[model samples]
Target: MALKPFLLTMLDQATELCHRLAAHGLVVASDGNASIRTGSGFYITRTRSEFENLTVDDWRWMPVVGAPTTGVSSEWRMHQVIFHQLPQVGAIVHCHPPYATSFAVRGEALDGTLLTETADFGKIAVAAFAAPGSGALAKAVIDDLGATGSACLLQQHGALTIGQTFQEAVQRMERLERLAMVQWLVTAGFPAHQTHE
Candidate 1:
């Protein structure tokens, strides 16, 4: 079926956002995935496609009312679960940034309270570890989203953020990584470099 102009726009924007995130080191290679809810179901990036550069034709539409996603990303289940559980989330981003993934590997949730801007981020939850791309991982992410609305850190995997738009979720992912970096620096006693901004 031919996608409407709006859906095509979404595919373009999602592709751009995915590339931007990858350029920023927020997601590397095919370790992360992105998706946006569609009228019938949703459209996700192709399996094993590098999100760094996606064309308009790269999105695969999966119906929410039909058979389960067949050859999509292993974390396709994660997006599926989110769309099912939360009616409000329109876009989802899953990434494995270095600093954030470090915390995830250690099963540590972000303590976003040190900075006023990130105070609300303190509620970010860490979903328990499960085999990657498995139904168990999807359930764990769903449960973590239950504890917070903005974002969740996947145990031994990566980070996931939801937003009314894909851009908002990407921003959340950036903030989550920043918070992690600051916390890491503080724990390591690294002196804060003053920026002349």
Candidate 2:
């Protein structure tokens, strides 16, 4: 099928974000996915595809108003719920970063109390545990979308972030992972540098 202009843009963006995820070690193999809304639908990375080697053919375009799950991410429900709830969001990126996943595994919040950078990214709440690809997980993510949160750590899972653009979503994911690392370092007895006048 011929790709629409918006979908074409989304494909390019998804490919870029996927490469970024792999290059920055935020995800391994086919562990992460990126998507962008085109019209009332979205273009997302295909399942089980490596982010670093994505191609135009690796994208699947689906209508946002449908529940069909033939060839989309296993977390499609969560993505759909989030994008539907946040009209301003144009892109979504989900990845499994080491530090963030570590915190998730421990059922800890990725809060700014650990570092200034975390504060800059706002507070990262750790959503309650929900089985992967389950409706429970989707609702858990929705509940975490309260105030002062742009990203959330899925307990025992990974991380999810949204943005006004593909680049913005990718940037948030990167920031979230960095904050996770800092949180780990601080909690592991490495004191963070204190800014002073």
Which candidate should be chosen as best, given lDDT against the real structure?
1
lDDT of residue 40 for candidate 1? 66
lDDT of each residue in 98-159, candidate 1, tens digit only = 99899999988788787787787666778999988788998988888883578989998889
- Kindly state the number of residue pairs that clash in model 1: 0
Please give the distance, in angstroms, between residue 19's alpha carbon in candidate 1 and its true position after superposition.
1.0
| Prediction 1 global C-alpha lDDT | 0.82
TM-score of 2: 0.88
Task: Find the 10 residues in a row with the least total lDDT in model 2.
Answer: 113-122
User: Cα deviation in Å at residue 23, candidate 1?
Assistant: 0.9
Candidate 2 C-alpha error for residue 131, in Å: 1.2
